[model samples]
Target: MTRRHFRLLIPVFLVAILGGVVWFQLRSPSAETIAAWVDQAEIALSNQQWKESERLAQLIADSGDREAAQLIAGETAYFEGNLESAFQTLGQIPLESRWRPRASLLAGYAAFRLQQPYLAEQLLTEAIESYPKEVDAFRVLSVIHYDQGNLRVAIEDLQQVATLAPEDARPWRQLGLIHRDFERFPEAEQAYAQAVQRKLPPVLEAEVRQEWADVLVRLARHPEAEAILDAIPPEVPMTAERMTTALAIAQVTQSPEQLDAQLAQAVKQFPRHAPILRANGVRALQRNDPESAVKWLKTATQVDPYDYRNYYELAQAYQRANNATAAKEAESEVKRLQALLTRLTELSEAAMDQPWDAAVRRELATLCRSLGKMELAKQWEIAASRCEQAR
Candidate 1:
């Protein structure tokens, strides 16, 4: 199979989700609005009588009281997973009065859910500006920035959410991750520690601790990170995530023997995992045993070529072994990965971040030259330029 494509999503570890949402409830209750609409709709909506509610909502929308019945219908449609209709319907309500803040916030999130990033940003920013106390609007804006790879800005925006609602753990967790990526270890440690203090369960605490370990590893405090890893019984849940942490530490520290031991332990526990097998190849690669590494990486591709990076690693192994022919075959598969890295590079420049994407492309382009494929180098350069243009 030809592996000549280049792309990458955020790495699983680095890509953190903002899980806990702290929605702001206005001190002025909706009880007054609900009272106004009681005759047309009801005190509460029943899922079974959706059509009744929709009809009543249309009447309320016609009456122009901002009663929120129509908004309820739209939100219901969204909750039911009728995404397109929900977006279309939600956009029509004129939320110019008291409900404007809530309406704009929901509309922003709906646009985001509909995959219209620009509209989402516009609507969410409007909501937050109109009602600076509306915490959810900042959360949604944080998402828009995060998807565009503006992690520092994303963290900045999420921090606004915490400032608006200081008791929320979600923002702290998110801030912790962004800080970790930026190598602000003390800040990351403190943010994550605050998240832990918020009484996140033992299960999630372990996950957060694993994140802490990653930050510690980057800071070259492997021993402290390892202590966190050692606290959990190996028999508990999140074994794969735990193993991934161990592997990262060993790989980063160039402890091939330690890596080998971790892989061996993981294999005994879960022999069939493709990642475990791939980790073995990585361990061998670290030790400068290219041929030996290929023995495992090839198996990894055979099991799952869709991963893309496995083939890239396999190509690296071939190059290291000095088997140029085999290396060329593997190198051919890197185009897609190259394209992806090139795009990431462009996005980074546009966001005024580091030029990691460009650096990655140059590295890949250099490899193409090594394989005597200058056309590939030019293609990558063009891709890089396109990214820069987008930036």
Candidate 2:
């Protein structure tokens, strides 16, 4: 209402307007400033500062450079476990761009995680074609083929990866795994040998050595297998599977006294271990100590009531000890189990007529052993070995 008050408010308004103008000028950075931001974003990405990289990438995109920003954003999404977003973002990169190969690889990986195998294969194939030396692309493609049950193709892809990265032992180790799964023991042995020669990390070397020894065992090179097993460092914790394998190797290579010592140690460590108990019972029977056999076999049966082999072995022990009533009871249990095994026996017999049916033969061998027919079990085991050799 007064002229003096109006004049004072006008000066205040002018000062506020000048401050606003300065703030706007500072907010809108120059082109050189944005370029520096982009460089910093790239550096952040290289250093795996995901949050800062993503924020700077968004700023770059807002400043009108979208391609690099999108690439970083896509990769960040992937590392953050946003598969769908990563796929969508990476898929938007133009095919002719230099970053398209990387985009395709990331998109392929996202598709694989999303369970879209066909799309993954398509994208990965494109990436590999565009970037032939990309070892990761080949590795993922091999995994896909392996999962799809195309073993030969998987092996070929892994072989290419090995050629591409000769100093990397992973491809050779993976090849050994595939060969071992197919029962191609000699091929597995060679692959594992290559991995070992390449000098892998300690954990991986131990793993490869264990698998190589297993292959040797399958090939009936028990002495070499035992040597390999013995060389495993004592520091490596013994897993149940490794313990079982060690027991088997000992049974084949060690004298009775040595075997007894190993069995005692195993039983002490694993009190409820049915296999060790069964092995002890068998060892007693071999020494013509039927009473000891009965004690061990009874404990084995109690530990693993479902294993018909224990019952059958118990019957033999009772008969040897002249316990007619106990032998009859155990024999009755064997008959019951035999009835349950009849259908499996029929299937195995049918498979026997087919060429190279190792799985069925092995199953039949196990079943026959439980039936107390060692002769038949041995024959089936031999057939299974022949089938494995053929593979």
Candidate 3:
């Protein structure tokens, strides 16, 4: 600790301090210039002037206004479906910047679009925790939580989002989803009803109506729900869809042979709708004439192997009828469709408490073993593992 050494260290310490200060100063944006550009770019985006917004973002990006530029660029790139690039670009924003929240939020969404679930989670969590007021983070977080089969967490995440955007129809839609996942049939019905009442866009409103009807059927309140739908005649005369709903109600209520009679009428009217045909197959399942159901649904699978419900019901029918050969075949188709549905439901957690998912998996495993397909049974055992995790 000589005086000479101390004096020499002071210069180095000052240099280090000065360099740190300069680095921080350099990191901050030119607020006036960035703000002007941000305003202009926002107007451009609102007016659908993508070209102008893109140009401004690129111009600022080149000038080292990294945070602002990255935010705008990510938004524009998302518009164009260049999600990977948008995620990478937006993720580069310095952590402490004011625009960092927005950048992280955008990056999370871009990562989701690019199918990078873990990355989406990390980025979105940071954005949400840093800016709890931002609804965008909650929206993305809800999906992430749902995909992991944590429906409770998903519900909590979406609740915050609903509070943040009470007027938004999306919140009500998400609320319906939470209720459905938990098998809270009555709550789901009300949530979807609210979504419909919110003056949503027509297409979305129609979808809400369908969802409401589904929850009603689950609650065994079929007649009331169908009456509600019947009151609102479809914009395009969707008698076919209404028929399918009616058939669904009959199936749920066990209104003896009602579905059978409806099927004949359905075939006479909207004979082409696969859903109606599938309903007929389901009615056959209820009749204890599994062989007839198997015979009919076999044709159904041939016509549409991708409809998992039909295939699953058909497999159940074959099993009930003690036709090991046909049951195993139908079940193989069920597995393929289940795998596809799992992939599609990645964000929506399509597997979580989905009524038929676990039943189908368990039956598939059982059928494989009964049919002497030991290896297939083992594969289905693995599928059962996945189904448990989803719950």
lDDT of 1 by residue, 13-49 (tens): 2343322111224323355655466344542343546
Quality of model 2 by C-alpha lDDT: 0.80
Q: Candidate 2 clash total?
A: 0
Better of 1 and 2 by lDDT: 2
Per-residue C-alpha lDDT of model 2 across residues 1-391, encoded as one tens digit per residue: 7999999899899999999989767776676766677568657865778778878877877765576668778877887789999999999999987668878988999988886665787899999887899887888888766544345667888999999989989889999997887679999999988988886766667777888888888998889887876777888776555565677788899998998898888878777888778878988998999999999999998887757788899999999999999999998987788785775547454553553567877877787777656886787776577557545
Residue 97, candidate 3: Cα error in Å is 4.7
Off by over 4 Å in 1: 1-120, 144-153, 176-193, 233-235, 250-260, 270-275, 282-291, 301-340, 348-391
Q: Which residue runs does candidate 3 get wrong by more than 4 Å?
A: 1-93, 96-99, 109-115, 143-152, 174-178, 201-203, 239-241, 250-261, 270-391
Cα TM-score per model: 0.54, 0.58, 0.54
| TM-score between candidate 3 and the true structure | 0.54
Tens digit of per-residue lDDT, candidate 3, span 1-391: 9999999999999999999989877975577878788778867875789889878887677667667777787677766778887777777778988888778887888877765656777788888877889887788878766654556777788788878987777878878977886678888887787777676776566666777787887787888777666656467345676677777876665456665776888868986677777777777777777877876777776665557777888889878988889878878877876775454345234334442255555665665555445675675565455556444
Question: Which candidate ranks first by lDDT, i.e. highest?
Answer: 2
